[model samples]
Target: MRNSMHHQAGFSLIARVLHWLMALMVITMLFVGAGMVATVSERHAWLLQLHKPLGITILLLVIVRIGVRWAHGTPPLPSDLPLWQRLAAKLSHLALYALMLAMPLIGWTMESAGGYPVILFDGVTLPALVEASPGLYSTLRFMHTWLAYTLFLIVQLHLAAALFHVLVRRDSVMPSMSTGPLPGAKRSKG
Candidate 1:
């Protein structure tokens, strides 16, 4: 039989690890992106170098994460949760997934339109998604910046909802993604 802690925690070990890993990577990428845009110093170049590969890594991980979620469905919400809250949860998750996929693609396309290379590492570069065009680059740059702002807002809301589950609701929602045993879960006295 599978271990009780794993069962009680709701999410598989791989899922929980991926969740936390991607969360950290995404948050770091957001900060790096903000820094990259906010300066013209030498540090801007360094941050840009960091940003490209990180965004691509996030794009790849989110794809894998979606596959895992599809294979091993997410745990159910609290049974007593209201209908509106459930709907909000579903919509927010969908938005998150959409942003995860869109942000990297748009960024790559923007770079392509600007005639810039997306170098992942030593001598590794991604192919251009679109032909070079200043007009298209300008449009994509605007969209990328605005979409980044939207992503930041959605991320904040997601954090607030997670905190609500942990602090206010004191529910299994938080435990579902945790590696530890679920709070208040029954233990066998073997």
Candidate 2:
């Protein structure tokens, strides 16, 4: 029982590292994106430069993350968790992965459609995903904006759920990805 519980309560170190790293990057990207859209000054250009490469980086990381997840499955939810909660957890994760993937692709395509080069850095330009079309660019821009809003809301919900598991239910969910043992977790005798 102790061994099984320990296994269930901890994520592999690589998984934890990836989780925290991507979380920080995603949060930073969100703010940078907001700043980019809200300004028309020189800052906007600077932010745009940052946003493009960051988005691509996130896209690449998420692909690697998905591969890791597939190779090493996540810890199971507490067996006693309510069915509704389980369903919600699964659905929310699916949504998160989908959005994480979709947002970058849409942004890349939008830029392509707008006839803008996706320059990662000096002399490094990504090929366009779509041909330039003003109409398509407009449509994709609308999608990218609404999807960003949706992603923000979902991220909030994910955070709330993690807190609920830690504070309200006093469960192992958060500790699975936590570097340190969560309060109330059992420690084996040496």
Candidate 3:
């Protein structure tokens, strides 16, 4: 009789790298954004410089990440996970990808409306997405800030869920995102 279990490898190397890289970039951007709003000092300008290019870079990487995700479908959740967890996981991931794409775009539009160019690394400038307008800038700035905070909250929740999976359930979800071999892929015969 054949065993019911199967061995499934973890995510591909490219997906793992992109996941970690985006995670780091998102965390750093959140901190820098907080700092940018907290102070009126010259450091704000420096942070803005970092923020613009970083946002642009994230935009580019996310575009590539989408392609990678399309080519390599997401790893499946464990079969035993509860319905609520599976639902939450799916919805939360969708939200994350949407926010990751939206925040940078909103910021770009905001800057464009504010008459600021997205000067990327080494003076690589991105064209404006919209005509400069003070009122439009205000609206986009508000939406961007609101979305950033929402993204931050959702990211915290995602992190908490990952920790719960690792520490509480001790599941394979967390391991699947890493560079190492998938744990417990081989099931022992009864």
Candidate 4:
């Protein structure tokens, strides 16, 4: 009973940890990406090294996060949230998940098309997933940039929504993901 209560109150421990860890990682990746494109210094190479591995790490974590979400499921929204808001929540979450999967793949493909190898860490390299071509590289790079900007916007929307829940709404929405026990651990109303 005590065990179940904790699990029901919020996201699983693993889920919470992954959510925050990935959140920080994604945000950092965004900044690193921006810095890489905005600079022309030797540090640019340093940023690229960090960005590629970080993106790949995120790519892998998101896969595990999806699996956790699938196996454990999400907590309910505030019971009183409007239908439109609820729909928006669903759509936005879908967009987030899609972007999480797409962005890294696009980055990887862009590197591959540019005839560059992605080193995961310590001389470990990920295989190139596409044929090398400067033309293909340019297209992939453009697509990656646009998708990244889209991700940035979507991330802002997500943050705003979370803040709304924490401040104005004063609901359990953010707590479900941020702090508390697993989502389904709470006892039933009956």
Candidate 5:
């Protein structure tokens, strides 16, 4: 029997690199974010300071990833996959990107409300998005934290779906993401 599984021309090398890099950054942010909330001390302050820079870096990388995705179309899903699964796949990805964008802005807004200068790696400082206010600071901080939990759940779902595709379906969904090619899909030469 001919394999219905087609390898999609997966993401380019640039996209793969950016994907892994952003993955690392996001994972680190999750840990750092949790630590920042859980602890109250000199260590917490140091970690909290790392949050802004890391968030901004992810923001910039995400922008680039979006651009690259647009420039180069993504590979098609496996033919055997049901329509509902395809739709869910698309929506899940959309949610991931939305959360990726939202988290950083939420952090920035919270910091702006807290009345602190957003220092970059060192020496560099970012202008405040808005004037500092006690009420807004508290509100944004709460939003950032709650949305983080939501993002966490969504990420777990995403991972589970990928594993499902790989193990049960024996599809290329997971590999397409990891290596940028699905079964029977052509690799982009560009």
Candidate 6:
């Protein structure tokens, strides 16, 4: 028999790993992005190089994450949730997934418009997608900034909800994502 006591219907091991890993990367990217916005010195040049590749990596990870989530459904919300609350949860998650995928593409397009090389770590580089156009760069940069701000707000909401589930509601939702499945989540037989 499967260890029903141990696993929650939260996420697969691969999914969980990628989820948290991407979370860490996103947070780091946010900090680096803030630094890039403020600093204009040789010291910050390395961050500029790191930013593009890091974003591209996050984009790839999000693609994998979406695939995993599609293959294995997300754990259902707590039964006590109202219909609207549940709907909000679903919408919030969808928004997060969308932004996670979109931000990098916008950043890439912005970089491409600026005629910058999409250099990865260890000297690998991607081809430029477009000639430098100050107009397109400005527009894309604005979109990327706004989208990131929206992502930041949504993430704050997501984190607050997670904390509420763990601390106030004392529900399994937190544990499902934090560790594994809840105590009573059923395992799907493939």
RMSD of each: 4.6, 4.1, 4.3, 4.1, 4.7, 4.4
Q: Give the alpha carbon lDDT tens digit for every residue of 1-190 in model 2.
A: 2223344446678779888998898888888988898989999999999999999999999999888877666666767789999889988988988988999999999999999988999999999999999999999999999988888888899999999998999877888788644445434221
Residue-pair clashes, model 2: 0
For all candidates in order, the CA lDDT equals: 0.84, 0.84, 0.83, 0.85, 0.80, 0.81
Give per-model TM-scores. 0.89, 0.89, 0.90, 0.89, 0.87, 0.88
Q: Which stretches of candidate 5 lie over 4 Å from their true place?
A: 1-8, 187-190
What does candidate 5's lDDT look like per residue over 96-127, in tens digits? 89989889988887888899888976888888
Candidate 4 vs candidate 5: the lDDT winner is 4
Candidate 3 ranges beyond 4 A from true positions: 1-7, 180-183, 186-190
- What is candidate 4's lDDT per residue for 70-103, written digit by digit as tens? 8777666656789999989989988999999999
Over 4 Å off, model 1 = 1-9, 180-190
Query: Taking the tens digit of each residue's C-alpha lDDT, what string does model 6 give over 28-58?
Result: 8877887888877874888877788899999
Candidate 1 — what's its lDDT? 0.84
Model 2, CA-based lDDT? 0.84
Model 2 off-target regions past 4 Å? 1-8, 180-190
Deviation from native of the Cα of residue 178 in model 6, angstroms: 2.2
Candidate 1 or 3, higher lDDT?
A: 1
- Tens-digit per-residue lDDT, 1-190, candidate 1: 1222223337777889988998898888888998988999998999999999999989999999889877776666666889999989989988999999999999999999999987888899999999999999999999998988898888999999999999999988888788544756423211
Native-referenced Cα lDDT, model 4: 0.85
Q: Per-residue lDDT for 1-190 in model 3, tens only?
A: 1112223346678889999999999989988998998999998989988998888789889999988877666666777889999889888988999999999999999989999877876768899999999999999999998889999999999999999989999877788887534656523222
Give per-residue lDDT, candidate 3, residue 72.
Answer: 66
